[model samples]
Target: MTNFVTKESLFELQSITNPVLAPNEQEALFIRTQMNEKENNYNAHLFHIELASGHLTQWTFGNERISSPAWSPNGKLVAFLVKRGEKQQLYLLNSRGGEAQELTTLPNGVNSFLWSPCGEKIWLTTSVKEGLAITDEEEKEDKKFPKAYVVDKMKYKADSLGLLPQNRHAQIAVVELSSKEVTAYTDAPYSHSLQGISHDGKTLVVAVNRVDNTDDVFRTPLYLVDVDTKEEIMLIEEDGYYGDAAFSFDDRYIAFGGSDQTFKNATHGHVYIYDTQSKNRQKLTEMFDVPVGDYAVGDTQQAASAPTVMWTENNDLYFQVSTEGDVRLYYATLEGAIYPASPENEHVYGYAIFKNGNRALMTVSNPTFPGELFDFDITTGERKQLTTFNAEFLANTTLSTPEAIVYPTKDGFTVHGWIMKPANYIAGEKYPLIVEVHGGPHTLYANTFFHEMQLLAAQGYGVLYVNPRGSHGYSQSFVDAVRGDYGGGDYEDIMAGLDYALANYDWIDEARLGLTGGSYGGFMTNWAVGHTTRFKAAVTQRSISNWISFNGVSDIGYYFTEWQMLADMNNVEKLWHHSPLKYAANVETPLLILHSERDFRCPIEQAEQLYITLKRMGKEVAFVRFPESDHNLSRTGIPSLRVERLAQITGWFIKYL
Candidate 1:
């Protein structure tokens, strides 16, 4: 017997990330992040394990967050990032036994870094603002004065990064370990991210948007720069999109992820290998149907990096792919033979291969489990559970396992999704159902643990979540279907999925149906209520209601509006027609609108518009505003507030459904 998972289970969950194999191949280092309920914050620290003995140990202690822990070439030292100052600074620790010491002292701090092949120097990626010094200068307290932010570019602000500092770019810098001297590498007035450092550390591959006025477009190409000469050469010609580059041990070939933008952002990503000598590239997974990276979306998984191509001594490259609501590890040979590397039925969010060539450490998670580290044998398919971060919680909580299902849509499309019954489900008892739609319209709801969904299940509500036409883990045509159509076919796909569930599952009460989602899903929830009277209640989180206003107010409004809606200020008629606000008068279902005050992605204004319209018409509608939260409030918001937010949702459904 197990206890029902409550909203407070948020603190019980712990996530593991960035597992790197030690040089000796007998140990692995990783970052473990968990919540501190009393402080309503989170604490992250470095942790390592002796792979052979399965002994776990924590390296750092504090009420602070830690990330990106890496081992030196000889495994005698460790370097990690922490925010002890105004910005995150690099910290180094000696494996020979010494307290961690702060390494780089940049005023703007570091974005990311790569360990040199010889471990003698480290490559630093940092943010640089023009008309400013790189070194820390004595701060002269400025006289209190009012200032106004001014911008001439379309990319003036981002969702999480907030307003972009004028003339600032992500640039590359180098640090000499012996001298502790820092050298600025690229100063092209464009953002540059260190992709791969050559085996000899003489050549570096960096991804940057060097084109003029790229603020209106999204594109980054890789370029090779000589360490000493500062000579740069473009790696890909006619680049649509490419990155995640890594050089082979012999520097013979470079493997990376690329997309020709066949369908723009909806294009399927593929793996490619470029010959350093020939300067020619080969599309290794050109025939693969899915995207090249882990496109799986979940609330529990945090800071999972974009998919990358990892090269081994052999002609093999390892990568992860999202397919049919599952993210798994797959490897492809130079000859283009792709096969599964890790186990099936679980999400491998992170992995590190040992130099010994026989084993790998995998960070795996699924619906029943929060996440943990696992030791996997590549050749024999043998595996061992390495970490039990969520074992006690698992044993204590009665979590619901989702049952996968596929139903036919009105347009002859097969929609894939999962149905989770209540945790304390009773046989032959009818339960109110809540239809969960995912955001992104591009990202996927895969086989991963989600605290919010489990909370709904534990509250005795059957949950239905499906990947409609606009979701990832499907074909390019499927993912691209929602483009320019908005509430058209994608809306039909969701309603049809719900109808199929009602017809197949007698345990779900049709009369007491409810609907909810965030971001894109929130938009769908708003659309569903306005168009149909089937749902008795609905909750929209950080959602969009008016496309016309969203296209101008959102952070990505400048380009994303045209890319998805295929309409800009020039076509206000089309934008308004697709907006859920246009159908607000027809809404009969009681609605709850949840939004973040600081959300620039969808903007809180969207929620305000819908709330005002419904309230003016004397309709059953309510709005809840989350303070000090962005678009990610549900996942990475204040721990106490996250619980309160869930209480609002379950409470709303309980009152109406």
Candidate 2:
């Protein structure tokens, strides 16, 4: 029986992420996540694989969901994080086999941890009180009394963490493995993130956002602390959100990744090397055009942090880059030589490279595959698939492969996109087409498998997804081009791509065009319908409609509007000019507004305002509000809700398009 992807098929899909290469390079550890259909929950377990023997072992069990596995330098023990009771804690187990032992019992719980180079100690991050704070019991009593929270800090509240703790700030601490002794390096009024330790274990690097008024500028400075003296020195003084620092094997140089906030959140990250001997810094990837990350946004898997700089024996850097919708590995030398180390059309979500750099363990996926660990030999350019967690499920499923496309936009610049025809596609058969725009306007729609696209194709719809001018993985000018211009260039790029597809591909039905997107893509969808009537129907998820209300509503709206649009309340005219709601009177297409109630990035109100206006005008529009969901509802929200959201999207297009 040949079964195609569906909303229910999401339950059968498994994701292999966070591949960690052991120090010996003989084995690898990774997280294999699967959805529990009956429970409607996700369960992640630690899995180990021998690179040479191809043998796999499930190391954890009982649905405790583990992540961030770190192997000791000696390769004898593995440390992983898991939520126990109410807090995330660290546990360690011997490689030979044994029950994991609780390592740390910090009051604030562990946020992130890294093993020291010598393997004798561990550096961890935890939030602690910054000032004289009331006890938890007292705080609860105060809440019972209904006292108002006096607002002081301009940048107080956040999305995921909810209301910011009045007194707590993330601090760094080091724990000795042998004696179980803990030492606090930072306390009070400052939050610190442990980057990495030096080879000799004498210095530990940390990143701190010490700006007095964070609302003014985005700045994260790097600091090197002497382990023995407990003295900190600001290294990498000129920076914007710099971290992920790693010392070379010989401790000659420290390499890290960051950007100068040229475009704020839309800025491309670059890798740099700081010479400890000469006390000077040099940019190794100044010429590399692509951003150093797997910045392609997707709902199927958790967004993996960008791979940090990995050092080779000869001081070459093995890092990841988002280029043309694929997150591939690239090797860069100090002398300005850079080239791809991974093969084409494969997305390396996360990777761990050995000090020798000749071998690496990475989680690789593509349009036809979910994801799996691969033992890669950099010098020989070979890869051996190490895990088959989803082989059985995928073997029974029919998938669609996308065709790479390059179409000219109206402005003379080129746009890159991918098109997936209906399953069992036939020549000269006109099929309904669905155009997908990605979020992050800065994020890429990459060569990775997307569940929604596959599901739509299963229903006999051709899906067209593209990286417009605002998307990453392109030239800086191309990404920044969307900023300030907003609907001008990016809108034309999308419309031009659609025009090219309809003109070039005979299998696409020009009369049955549909549009759907989430976040920034949602914004574009709203803009598309108001500007053009080509799309018969459009589905917008977590979209922004009215910039006037969005600036005050969204968590990042105030700064994001100013940074991305170059407009604020002061420039209401420009803001309104770019707002889709400003042109709501022109909309005629049936619109499906999907949003989460708790989406702080693109709040549900954005949907409400658009939905209400369309309804008042007697236009065709429907709104669906997901309960207890956040901005990441599509990606990491409730399993049942995710299925429902997909069903609604597929149903909307099927009923209209």
Candidate 3:
């Protein structure tokens, strides 16, 4: 007998990421991430899938975590990153057999690395202080007697990496595989990212901002350094953010994905090719309306970073595009013609192209299951399931399939959304509806397996999620429309989607409607309840309550508020005009505020402000805080805490809705 998906069953699911085809093309290497329910954390290890035999092999063991597995060009060794003490360093393991060996022990550790074409050396990026090379002992001593942080730069704190070192910047380095000797290439004050080495391994490319006194993080230029001489040459000097670069097979052109920041953060990322000889750049994705990266947000697992561009030997550029909530692979020719490289209705999170250009190893997820590896035949359009990581769990579990719907707003503008039916549906029975908003007012709710939505469906509630105007899967104008006017059209888009569902679906209980969202979605939930009493209950997570305080508190609030809301602390009236806290007394729905204690993006103080204001106003509100959690608590936080969060959301709706 099949069973409905339960929170406990979350441990049964596995995550597959970073699929890279072996140089021989007979197998592929990927990281398998699994949750240890007993320990309440996640463990990831390296694994390889055999193409012809359909066999899976675990290349690493123990409880230690590892990631970013790269196969050497010569197919002799596989190098990956493993954490030791305070830093993550590179480790090498023989392809045939033997235990892995540590390659380098840099001070701050390696962030990312790439194997050279000859497999004789590995290029990497590591952080270092501008003039001070602090040793391990000094690093330990500083922790014993902590000093005050001297503030200098505008970009001090990041969401994931936390507080940045005063003068530390990421620099490029190379390690000779044979001698195990490391050499620093460039020493600069600005942070640099290691893109890749040329085909002949003589020239290296790194993305950085050498332009003076510019605080914009989105605008970066590409720089090429002679591997032996260490001489740096600027390639393209356009005022745009550029990374995910790859040199053409013949070393003539370099393809990268970026946006010119026309609309700031909401701009669509396009594919651009730079001619090495002429230093001229041409846009390759001018006609492709969708953004050139994965923007589908979910709570099922930790998201994987996909390459911005994958190049074939023939200079065929393949990349992923987020469109209408689903991520699809596309290949483009030099002349600007583009076509789909993967099937429809499937989210291709990450992919690695085989040298033959006809096959690719992809990490694919659909409505039915979590991510898994599959061998895709580009020519024949044949896909073979390479790994069955979630086969057992999926076989015993029953899930609801979402029905895609395209509806119009009050202004007749079309919007895309999905409605997931209750797991055990009947003909005439009415079911309660839950409207879920995604966090990135710029993100999408797509055709992927969302664990929270599935769990809600299992509990007899219909789940509805939509992509508003500011989402990335649409045109450039649509995404930019939500920048200055947050609560106007974007709010109507969500309400119109709910209206369409209630009008079209007779089995929905309009009186028992509930709303929930995180980040931007959380902000929307707060705005919706204050603006209207239609929703009976609501849950807001990691949300913003006051734009005034948000500008001062959030890590990205200073610039993000100016960019998204078109207002800063200087504009007090405009900032408070969009703040949900300003209208707290108007809230009629029972609201549940969930927030992470350490979330710097939308700090927990935002939740506190909302809870106290609603309580002072004698409104129905409750606050729940998770300690040591950040903005990503729902997705990559502590495993046990994630499960409890799902329970809290489910229980709140069950009691009120």
Candidate 4:
């Protein structure tokens, strides 16, 4: 182990996520994940923690992929999803102690699971394909014959899932824990996800979008279904995203997260409360400026699932909010009053709010730390670190903590960013600067642990990353500003951020500058090198070069282009006008293109086109292609490949800068 961060530091990192607070309030269960270098894979296990003494205990072992752990109401038994076979199946274990028993045998793997209030049964979401066999034992012939995949739906393909199976829909199932028998509930053509259930277990809320065209965004309609009578009631009639739902303990209120698409993808998800008896819904947090949940983008976490929008025992709803550069816990009442419950300037990626609502078990991380569990007293705003999973990483690494920076954009708006000096920094020594941009255009760069940024800093470079216009964690207008102006103001904001950093800090080398980003950030990196020669070198990862071809090739291109550009193929002129390929000839910086072979978000063809075009022009460009990786190659791809990706980026910058 070395003091400075290296490729090996990624393997030493451990992430604790998906916290399930036990019913007794004295203990909690969470998934602890670590990158195992020996096997070159990720290993996940169920871990239990005593809240009072902060004693953590591992419940499961091996290289198993465990997820969605739910504790029974009595805290006597715990259930989770694990994949010991072809698909993930439900498994139950005693909370006190016991081997987990496999509980479900379904045609498709379970997507999500939730324990009913009574704990008599477990409701789950699993795929149901018409022509598929009922068990994994019956699918041997399909592997041998390999039938052709039918593509009749416009939304058939996705980034990670690839082309979806034909006639397959996410349906519901229930496992009778005592008898170990599973029952197929209502079969739906569309997806029917189990969101939350009432205390009485007589009703369940499910996430389902019964729309004609799947291309439309924010058309989700949650349904409150009667479990016994099979009756359905539409929770929200408006076309919006109301997926994350939870029923109050008394069944008096149902709270959910949604937005009416008033600002398209930029709209902040608001919290809503539906009165079960009155049949009236109240929109809370309507004036809240930030979105709900942890939208911070980073690679140091694994299996980090968002907590369902839930209610406290006092009927106050609690949720996480992405604001500025942090994700903090916040609770809102049915009266619409909201208040922060956790500390500021950290990423609360996962947490379990206690029934009393005054305490919580949070997985917190900062720039220097991977995620770890902490017992947080919400009312008192006190927190005690409960896990030392990354103790080795903490002791061995000399990481550079980011200094928050704010500067005015070309326009009137002020931009937020950070500057991390080199790990071995001297007061007067000028170092090379690398301006890193985040993708999503809708996602913001939070003040959480970023492995690549740390790697760059450790390599003797000042890493400056910014949340330019169109990045979330800001105002809706700021995020929507770059919708049609890809390279217009957004690009200017990035440059202005660079200019501010250089002007304000004397330790940064003015001439030796590098640029980098992925996805939208990758597109920007390409755009920056093409439009200006300010940077001596640049690296573009999982980028978009030509929007025209991207409109058809990318998994989400068809609707995404229209969503981001506000136009389609009919506006080829506009697409080309904003594409980085249009200005590739002007590129003078030696650029390194890194793309995943199986990436469907931007697709590998985009990188191929750029690399080929740059090679044809005899430009100083090199392309590194990673196999079996999608758009998340840098984050959750193969561990060896992730290491290689870091090496390529740092090596390129070291060579040119």
Tell me the lDDT of model 4 at 431: 98
| lDDT of candidate 1 over 7-84, digit per residue (tens) | 888888888888888878888888888888877788888897998899998999988778888888888889888976
Evaluate model 4: give its TM-score: 0.97
lDDT, model 4? 0.86
- Per-residue lDDT of model 2, residues 300-326, tens digit only: 665355457888877888888999878
Query: Candidate 1: worst 10 consecutive residues by lDDT?
Result: 132-141
Off by over 4 Å in 3: 84-86, 133-137, 142-144, 211-217
Error of 1 at 300 (Å): 1.3
lDDT of each: 0.85, 0.85, 0.86, 0.86
Q: Tell me the TM-score of each prediction against the true structure.
A: 0.97, 0.96, 0.97, 0.97
In model 2, which regions exceed 4 Å deviation? 84-86, 131-143, 178-181
Q: For candidate 2, list the clashing residue pairs, or say none.
A: none
RMSD of 1: 1.6
Encode model 3's per-residue lDDT on 1-657: one tens digit a residue.
999988776788888888988888888888888888876777789997778998888999876678788899888899999974469999999999899999988888899998888888898888887775522322444566878877666667766557866667788777898888877766778878887678888887888886545545557777787877878787666666777778888999888888876888898989988888897789899887789888888766554767899888888889999987789999888889898888888788889988657888899998877989888899999998888889998989999999999997776568999998999989899999999999888888877888888899999999899899998788888888899887889999999999999999999999999999999999999999989999999999999989999987888988899999998878989988998998898999999999998898998899999999999989989999998889999889988988889889999999997
Show where candidate 1 strays beyond 4 Å. Answer: 138-143, 237-239, 356-358
1-657 per-residue lDDT for model 4 (tens digits): 559998888888888899888877888889988888888878889999888888878999987789888889898999899976458988999988989888887767778888877888888888877544333333444566777876666676888778867666787888788897777786657777887888888888877877545865557678899998889998876866676778888888888887776777777777888998899988888888878777799989997987657778898878989888888889888887888887777899988888888888889998888878888888787888888888877887898999998888757888988999999999989999999999998998997999989989999999999898898887778878999999999999999988889899999998999999999999999999999999999999999999999999998898889989988999899999999999989999999999998888899999999999998999999999998899998888889999999989989998999
